[model samples]
Target chain A: MIRFDQVSKRYASGNDALSQISFELQQGEMAFLTGRSGAGKSTLLRLITRMESPSQGQVIVAGRNLNRLTRRQVAWHRRQIGVVFQDHQLLFDRDVFENVALPLKVSGYSKSHTERRVRAALDKVGLLGKEKMRPGALSGGEQQRVGIARAVVHRPAILLADEPTGNLDPLLSRDIFGLFEEFNQVGVCVLIASHDLGLVASRRRRIITLEQGRLIENREQRADVGPG
Target chain B: MSARDRKTASERSRTLPQHSGGGLLSAHLEVLGDSLRRFAAAPLSSAMTIFVIAIALLLPALLGLVADNLAGLGGNFQDSARITLFLTGQTDDGEAVALSEDLRSAADVASVSYTSRSQALAEFQAGSGLGGIVTELGDNPLPASLSVTPSNREPDAVQALVTRLQALPQVESVLVDLLWIQRLDAMQAVVNQLGRILALVLGLAVLFIVGNSIRTGIEQRQREIEVVRLVGGTAGYIARPFLYSGLLLGLFGATLACLLLMALQLAVSGPIDNLLSLYGAEFRIRFFTAVDALSLLAIGSLLGWSGAAISSLTRIYASPP
Candidate 1:
């Protein structure tokens, strides 16, 4: 579950990134956040992860107010949420297995448990066989999949992806969304931020659109439309 | 795999693994091993850092040895200093012998040997090559003298003893031949002070070298660090490997420095031996003991840890995740 009550974010450069924004998503809900380039989508996601605190109002995720969490608590709180980025953010110097196992390693999972979990996550993303290969050797779609495996390896309750398929082709984008759909079907909360309105509108899921640091639209797709 | 396996795998992955007490310890050990692997991966860079640190550490150790040898040389000069007590012209050989016995029993006097007036005249004549002239002159002109060596070579203690002996009856004069001792003591004091200053300067230099190395390491791994932070790695977890890398570099540098010092000591030992023989002195050069070497290693490790910790922790917190 995620909630933003009258939340506002202003950068030190005197630029407002978000202003009095308010929203909530129930547990296990799948949604997409759409906005223009300078809109507050990234800021909103960062607030949820406590990467950057809201300038004004409270941002709560999974029943905990992020404002009150200590530095140590922030790290622990981050463990409950999985985040994917546009750049794939994988350490190329290490192998795919190492990249995926990072979250499990940080959590102090037993070596056997880490191996099992890593294999499971990689297998879910169809990257199990490429564990020994460096991420540098992977295609763009494969790199994104590896990033997805790393995020979900620890079994986080909430998954936040920031423009995850920004660099992918239209077909690859659909495949990536399909992976998110599979995870959502298994009851993981998925929230994605993107500027691809055409693809976003075609998917027929929940959409919250932001414009100029303010929420301008909130709509859920009709069930009759189904998956496109 | 099949959906059945997927169902169970998701179920198992849903629950977070329970951590035993040993888990944290193992994680720390893993991080340490990871740092060693990193060092192995960049052998040339690691060796360069270690070499710089070794040279920085070596200067101080060599200075310490120089100070030790200088003190030893001063001790030798102090040991040879003696106070000569010349008896009055009227004192006979038997009286001079009795005075020497009394001087030997004194608390500050280490040894006392008497030279009768006739013996002193004979030694002076032989050295001056004026034996025939002295024989024509008749009666011996030199007075009986007692050579007094003090048990304590300290300047103040020797001066105190000299004053005490000069006040005695039947003594014409007390001559203390220790100007060279005074100059040597002053020189040794200066050398000791310089050694301490050099150690402090070189110690700081080592710290900076280690810190710079760690800074570069952090820069190279900046993206890795950012990824770790995003994935819920604590600051301590992120810093563990860098700290270990610093410590390892410092320790290796210390070991190399010790090796360098030993090689230098061996190379100069022969020359030192020849010089000692030329001076007819029994002084031998002493190398650092095991304790000293161990202490140097400890110091190097501590310096490395401090530099790494300062750089790593500050940079980790200063930058945004």
Candidate 2:
């Protein structure tokens, strides 16, 4: 579970990136974070990870206050949360298997254990056969799928994705969200931040909209019309 | 959540980075290992860089060894260290001989020889190259001297004995010819000071050498680092490879330096030993022992760790959300 209570984040430049944003994400709940660019969606996710401290309030994830955890503890806490990026941030130098296994390796799993887990995660993303391939060897959709597999590979209680489908085609994007939904069905809390309104509206899930560092809307689950 | 209980091993492993030091450690060795591996992978470039570091480090190490050799030589000189105890003109030869016997038992005195006035004059005439002139004068100006030798040739020791000798009623003013030794000690002191300064400058040079190499590696793997971070890898996780790079640089450099130092010893050993034989000494350069090698390895590893710390900070911090 993740909760933000009156959390405000102000940059050193005196710009408030998020203004008193209060929200709670229940375990196994999937929600879409809809916002314009720089509207505090990414800031919210960053606060959850304790990458940046809230200026005035508490941001709790994994039952620990973001401000209270030491820098080291925060890093450890992050190991349990999977993050998928818009850029499909995969290491080109590392083969697909190693990149996905990276998280497990850092967690001190043995080589045999890492291989088993990496393969299973890749299998979930339909990348089971591409384990030996490099990120450069994959297509954009496949790359994003790799990122998704990597994210869910750890089976983190919480998953935060920032425009994971931004670089994919509609067909691939649909499939990506379908993958997210499949993972969600298995009780993984998924929080996706995106500018794609049609995509979020079509999801028929809870939508928390942000405007100018403020949460402007928290709508009930309702599938929009005129969407695929 | 209870969901974690059902999660497969692969599912649980997706978020880890390769640089897991431990629950308590920040993965310093992981970073160091990666840095070393990266450096090792590029044998030629790594070799050249390490050679450069070796040359820089070897200077101080070599200088230290040379200074040690000099100290060894000085100790030998001290083994032959001696003092002269002169008798007054009116002192009797029997008194001089008796004084020598008594002084021989002193704590500081290693040996003493009684030189009577006739013996002093005779030896003086034979070796002064002024023997004809001395005979024509019909009188020996040279006073009876007790040639005194001590166990050591320290400045203070010689001065202390001189003071004791001067206090004798039957003795003339005590003279010490340790000015040359004083000059040598002063020279060694200067060498020590210069060696310290040289080590410091070369240490910084080692840092830059590894740092620049890490920087280049960072640039090469900029994308990969960003990827590592996005997958929930910590700054330490992202920094491991760079740390390894710095370590490898230092280790190889140290190895190269050891080789170069050995070569230098070989090149100079035979000739230097031959030259020392002329001075009737059997001397050889002392190579570094096992402890010294360990110390060198530790130093090289430390320099690399420092470089990785500095170079990886900015680069790791540059990763995006």
Candidate 3:
């Protein structure tokens, strides 16, 4: 669970990225954060992960105040919340299996467990058969899926994706979104930030839209859940 | 796949997240191995780094050998280096014996003995094969003399004895075998001081070489490190491998230096031993002892570790997850 109460973030460069934002996300919930470029969508996610602190007000995730946790605790907190970057952040030199197994390895998983989980994560991404391939050898969609596999390889409690489908075709985008929906149905919270208004227009889920560092809309999408 | 049988391995791993990175032993070895592998993958960098460290370590080791030999250069044949005190020409037998005894009791004297004129004549006659002829002539023209052999140690003590014997009323002359041993001692001291300074300078050079290598390694793996941190690896986790690499490089460099020095010793050992034998002396060259060898290894490893630690400071601090 994440709660942002009157959270305001101002950069040192004298720009207000987020202004007095108040929001809460419950367990097993799937939500979309929509905003134009520079509207603080990533800033919100950064606060949730405590990558950066709020300028004012409280930002609490999973019960601990974002400001209260030590750097070490913040790192541990990050372990439970898997983050998928827009660029997929894969190390090119290493093979796919190692890339996905990285989080598990770092969290000190046993070899057997790491191997099993890394393969499973790859299977979920439909790339189990390509475990040894390098990122450079994979297609854009496959690479992104590898990134997804890496994110969830530890079976984190939540998945925070920033424009995960930003570069994918419609079919792959649908499949990726379906993947998120599947994980959410299995009790993993999903918070996706994107500027693709048309893509989220049909999804029957909560959409929080921000404009000029302030949330303008926080409503459940009642219009449609189109094209599976 | 059916949900019942489709459980992800990631879930299985998540069931126990604290046992995967291997225990501390494997953890350390894995890091060391990775570093070695990375270095091996780049033959040029590995060779260059090893060469620099080897040269740094060898300079000190060779100079230490030189210093050791210099200190022992003249001390090897100590007794042959002292002055001998001879009794006066006109001294009577009784007077020569008494004077020899008195000199023997002197603080600087190691030993003294009176040689009667008759005994001196006999020794000369026998050596010159004029024994029967000299025996016929009889009364012996040789003067009674004392052979005084002072202690081979303490240059100042021997010098003081030379002055005291010359001042003796009954004594005739004094001879110091190798008066320049005092100069040898002074030269050894200077060489030792130079060795220490040279070693210090070379140590800094090695540190810089290793530090620069580690810095390049950090730059090369910047993205990999970023990805590691993103997945929950701490700075310590990331630093462990580089530190191990540095230690290994240092140890290898020391080994290289020692091996080279050993080869040099073997190559010149025959000539060096022959030269000493020509002087009718036993002066065998000593290789490094076990303690000295271990010290070399430890010093090299420490230098490497320091370099890597210093380099890691900048890399870890600057990296962003």
- TM-score of each predicted structure versus truth: 0.87, 0.82, 0.84
lDDT score, residue B111, model 1?
98
Q: How many residue pairs clash in each candidate at the backbone level?
A: 0, 14, 5
Task: Summarize candidate 3's per-residue lDDT along B4-119 as a digit string, tens digits.
Answer: 12332243334344753354456567677778889889988798889889989999888898889876776775655655556666778778777877877876677876678778
State model 1's lDDT: 0.86
Q: What is the TM-score of chain A in candidate 2?
A: 0.95
Q: Write the per-residue lDDT of candidate 3 for residues A1-228, one digit (tens) a residue.
A: 778999999999999999989988877789999999899999998888766788999987666687887656666777777888889999887899988988876777667777888888999989999999999999999999999999898888779999998999888988888899999998787999988787777577889998989999998876556643
- The C-alpha stretches of model 2 lying farther than 4 A from their native spots are A8-17, A36-38, A222-227, B1-33, B40-49, B85-93, B114-145, B166-176, B208-226, B234-236, B282-291, B310-321
Write model 1 residue lDDT over A1-31, tens digit each, in one string.
7889999999999999999998898767899
Candidate 2, residues B122-225, lDDT tens digits: the string is: 99888888888988998888899988887556888887887888898988867666776777677777777778888899989999888888888888886776
Model 1 lDDT tens row, B82-167: 88999998888888888888879888889998988888888988899989988998877788899999998899899899888889
Q: lDDT values of the candidates? A: 0.86, 0.78, 0.81
Query: Can you give the lDDT of residue B7 in candidate 1?
Result: 46
Model 1: colliding residue pairs = none
Best-performing candidate as measured by DockQ: 3
Error of 3 at A131 (Å): 1.6
Best by TM-score: 1
